[model samples]
Target chain A: MGVTSRGFAVLFLAGFAAQPAFAYKIFVSNEKSNDVTVLDGDTLEVIDTFEVGQRPRGITVANDGNHLLVAVGDDDTVEVYDTETYERLHTLPSGPDPELFVLHPSGNPLYIANEDDNLVTVVDLENRSMIAEIPVGVEPEGMGVSPDGSVIVNTSETTNMAHFIDTESHEIVANVLVDQRPRFAEFKSDGSEVWVSSEIGGTVSVIDPATHEIKHKIEFDIPGLRPEAIQPVGVRITEDMETAFVALGPANRVAVVDPETYEVLDYLLVGQRVWQLGFSPDESLLFSTNGVSNDISVIDVEDREVTKSVQVGEFPWGVVTTPD
Target chain B: MMPARFLLAAAFAVAAGGAAAQEAARLDPDWPCVQRKVPTLTPAAIWTGPAIEEAGDWRDDEEVRELVNLLSQRRVPQDEAEATIESFAEGLPAEERSARLTLLFAGLFDTMNAERSEIIEGIERYARHQKALVETIREQKETVEVSPVGTGSEAEQQLFWNLRIFEERRQSLPYICEVPRLVEQRLFALGRAIGTVVSE
Candidate 1:
């Protein structure tokens, strides 16, 4: 169609908006590298690298498209960056050694797992101040909030329990014992169940969210691979909640399982010490950070194979996809 | 002939009496030095201690003999060899003492290099394990979540719980890395102290 400059500009804007906004930009926090590596999910290519605070680990794209949140464990602060320009935006003062975090669905409050103090510091995002600190078990590692936003789960390493906290009161309502050294917890999209992965125990326990009872334990076996090597860390559940991808630490593999049946369908080999996993918004691609290899293994979910391995900073850990 | 025999017997008796008298005179402080010629050993003739005495005894035992031969062949320090032998001897019981001492001496006499090698292997294993743990925890920070999601109210609550997990992970890293280094350093200092004593 022929058009004037203003008409062409209007057509271009319409075309861009009409296109499916499914593809998401991904940000990976390289812990040892102390930087964030940005990737274009569709092309599986690194777009940019931005220097972050010391030892950036867990990364999350804020619900609003404006900022990217990163957990800088060494710096003891959670840093926010402008997503468009990839510039430092602000810092959230999380109490002592902030590690992993989960955002409330409402997005005004931030739940931070301060690994050093054995407490979860709740921060008011608007005020940028800690609202409350909830005590938890030893070595709290992974966390997840229920889809309904009624409950929150915090997994403790030594305690081996996933503690359920009431979102309103910020109090631990229930504690369900799971496998040894529970490192991460993920909630089913429907809020029907919760999954906890144990690093030392080499198993993932699927728990009934309501009853806080373990429904099943998923185990792995491969000769010469020690149970320790099969340490399960980052867990990603598909939006449909039909499949679960678990990063097997030191094993350099990610196990894809049927969530409903608790059946492991296949083990996709990735890189050394795979620590965290994130998926594009469209759920077509999966990205995992290989801590030892210092690379991000991008998986084509439909094909169930590693499509590309992008070299990142030293010891990449947590990864998140930003909406494009 | 009888007279001559009596005279001879008397002379013999007199000579015996004179010899006895001379022996008694020698015992007396008044005895003349010229009259009594007594042989004297020098101060250096007396045994120094058990170590010197045992060195002579070491010649008879096969294990001791082997150890001495080995030490001589290996050119180990004389004091170290002596000390090793003494330690082995002290550990032995009275009944099997000789055999045990001999065996120990023989085995250790020429095996100083082997002992040193064993010690090095042990230290290397310990150090490597310590380093591995430190590196593992240092790398653990990457796997940890250190930031909270500040979004909607519901999301903020989720971030709060997630942060609890991160704090636990953070607290553990230093404990895992620092505790081992502290313990290893302490153990190393103790080893150095012991080494100083042994070297001396």
Candidate 2:
């Protein structure tokens, strides 16, 4: 049973295509160190670290589950890398200062936020060129793709608005103003509501996608701390669409909230200045990247407690894990 | 050039659609402003800042918290307010009947000049205080960004830029010009009252 080069390639691709339900590898984008740190998702231990662009912030596992898409702001390009080999594949036409992005379900067109330029650059994955540069609000950071892939939302920090763009037309159909300094946007698995976290407002605004208006707000109140310190930044809803975890920027806590009630259930204390979050493919374990502490805290989603902390590179800004 | 036009068009469209977010009040609208909305400081809390039992975060620095409590009122402090306007309100009625009208007039002019000085001094202090607030926020920001526990080197370049922008004279200086006019209006009203009393 000798495996030739072609047969090995097939086997390699099959391993990626059919990701085992239990296998998980977490990738963290470190901004200050200009690298990406890979971790064992189960043990929460540092597996490897590879040099990326000048300042890598936003990272995402490609929908195909074989590549990692990282928005290198300093380089003004979204560099793709082979998930297994950890080698740079190519760069996307992400315009200037690409910070965060969301890929289409088909993984053909990529929607990226260019923070400095105040535009969302849509690049065609097949052509490796920009398809359309959608003009968004100032300092765009968060990108959310709908479950049905019909529309995508981009939240602007300084603008303090969540903009909904029609995927087909690639135009902003509506803009809904939320609280101050909106940093991240997330849609429920069922596509019923979209949650946007306002860093300065210290609250998560639950907006109705159909109405394009804020339905309710989820606020945090930590014991012995002022409300101002509860800066909500990263938000992720669970696969079952029952729970949501929001990363508090300076508060160093992740608030577990009920999606239906918009009530904060509990605050899970993690490392310092928790910036972004990731989850395993099976949605069992959740990972949080603490930039100030330079570590990743793994939490059992069911238990809602931080089980382990894995030290990584400097100032980790984003995190993504292998797909199921 | 195209981007400029696109930006203008987008602004106009957003304005027309009534979907633009409310623009925050800035000393200078042209420059980027720092986020200052503290959640615990409700409208009622701002109205009665000193009465707040526990302003949790600001408690670390008693002096800064005190200053913040004062600024939350959105006006000059009591001592400065008194020296500028309140003294004039009560100064004239205290003069003796034997006090010459001419002397009283001279004193009134002197008092106005003194009030002017105090208002100018208030502007300087206010600038210094606001600059300090920027520094405090920068230090807090660096705590999570590039402080001892975090990565990077000594000194924060973003904070330096933040301080410069926050303290830019063009922004807050206009407010300084307005304070004097408002204080003078108060003094002028008091002077009129003094004149009427003498006429009677």
Candidate 3:
């Protein structure tokens, strides 16, 4: 079993295709540093830190794992980068102040939440052109798309409504009002429910995607923490749609909840001001971007414990993993 | 005079670790806000109407300066501010409206962004002072614990008051943290109002 370049390449390809996940890189957007910290997922070590546009907050990898998109709010553009080589590819014409965005499940057009413009700018990822600028509510920051790419949900922080848009038409189909300062929206993998996290309202509203009505409101009550401090920001529901992980901003914990029962199963403490979350491809590990603490807390999903804390750039705001 | 043990217990009660943790997370260790410290705001963040250079030498215009002062005051309600901007634009001749509105936005951005920056600096200073107070309290507590009985009374009294002050400021931090955001929000609203006038 002598190691060779060809053999290593074959093994790498096979590793991604088969079980026993390949060495995926975790990308974290540092808001203040204006850079992305790349960490080896398997080893959980800092591989590289690359400079990005100003105020890079929301970050995600393309479905094919070829490109990485970063929403640089101050730059007012989604910066595209070559994921493998960390090369600057091009920029998407994201409307003014793009804080967060979501890719179509198939990964074609990128939907961005322009916080300053009150619009969701849809950009064609392949062609690198603006497709549409759909008018949304005030301070639209959080964006999510359905598994089938039929609907796109934009949660407006000030308006406190989840505006669901029909992907094909680019027109708002429904507006489901939730609590105040709805900062992030997440859809269950099965598309059965939509979870909106309200930062100021301190609650997570579980909306029935079909009916466009509130199904349940999940609230946090950590004994020692103040109610106002328990603000919910980002949410990730498991592919099975049985469990959800909600990042409680400033409360410094991610609440594990049973999406079926709407009960908080447990609260795992992470770094301060946990803003967003990302999961490994296998769903075994979860990574949280802790803004104030400048680190990512790696949570063991099955154990429900924070296994490791990896320090990165200043004010880390978003996290995403490579598909491989 | 408070007893040494009582002073020691109070000294141990200081939240130095929490304060240190908060400071350690940031580049300027003094920044205590959970919001990423943006020391200053770029005009692009709020002002989307026209290039700021178009409104250069806005300070030379007394009326524009006055309007900037009036509008930048957060005490003035947003709706009232919008009405003022609309009225100001309406009173101007159609030819002068866009230039005047652009000037107004530039002045407002300059005034408000500077004000916001000052507030952020003040917050950092406040946090720095708070950290010093924690350090002093820690030292005084050690003195009270190790020193012979009544000799440390003066240090104990100082430590007690410093602890009280630290706690008071810590409790007030969350509110102070909102000040910069509030200022930015006002600037955003005012900028939009000015943009509406220019468009109309």
Q: lDDT by residue for model 1 over A12-91, one digit each (tens)? A: 99999997675567888888778888887677788899999998877787757677899898889999999879889789
Model 1 misplaced regions, further than 4 Å: A1-23, B1-200
What TM-score does chain A reach in every model? 0.93, 0.92, 0.93
Tell me how many residue pairs clash in candidate 2: 0
DockQ of model 3, rounded to 2 decimals: 0.01
What is each candidate's DockQ, to 2 decimals?
Answer: 0.01, 0.01, 0.01
TM-score of 1: 0.61
TM-score for each model? 0.61, 0.60, 0.62
lDDT of 2 at A113: 94
Query: Taking the tens digit of each residue's C-alpha lDDT, what string does model 3 give over B1-200?
Result: 45545644554464434555456444556777766677776664344466878667789889999999999998898779989998899899988888888999989888988999999999989988877876787777666544445455665566666766776787798899879877876776677568667877
| Candidate 2, position B192, lDDT | 30
Q: Could you say which candidate leads in lDDT?
A: 3
- What overall lDDT goes with each candidate model? 0.69, 0.71, 0.84
Per-residue C-alpha lDDT of model 2 across residues A256-294, encoded as one tens digit per residue? 988888788988767667878878888888889887667
**Consecutive 10-residue window with the lowest summed lDDT within model 1 chain A:** A221-230
Per-residue alpha-carbon lDDT of model 2 for B40-82, expressed as tens digits? 2121210111222232333354443443333223255533633
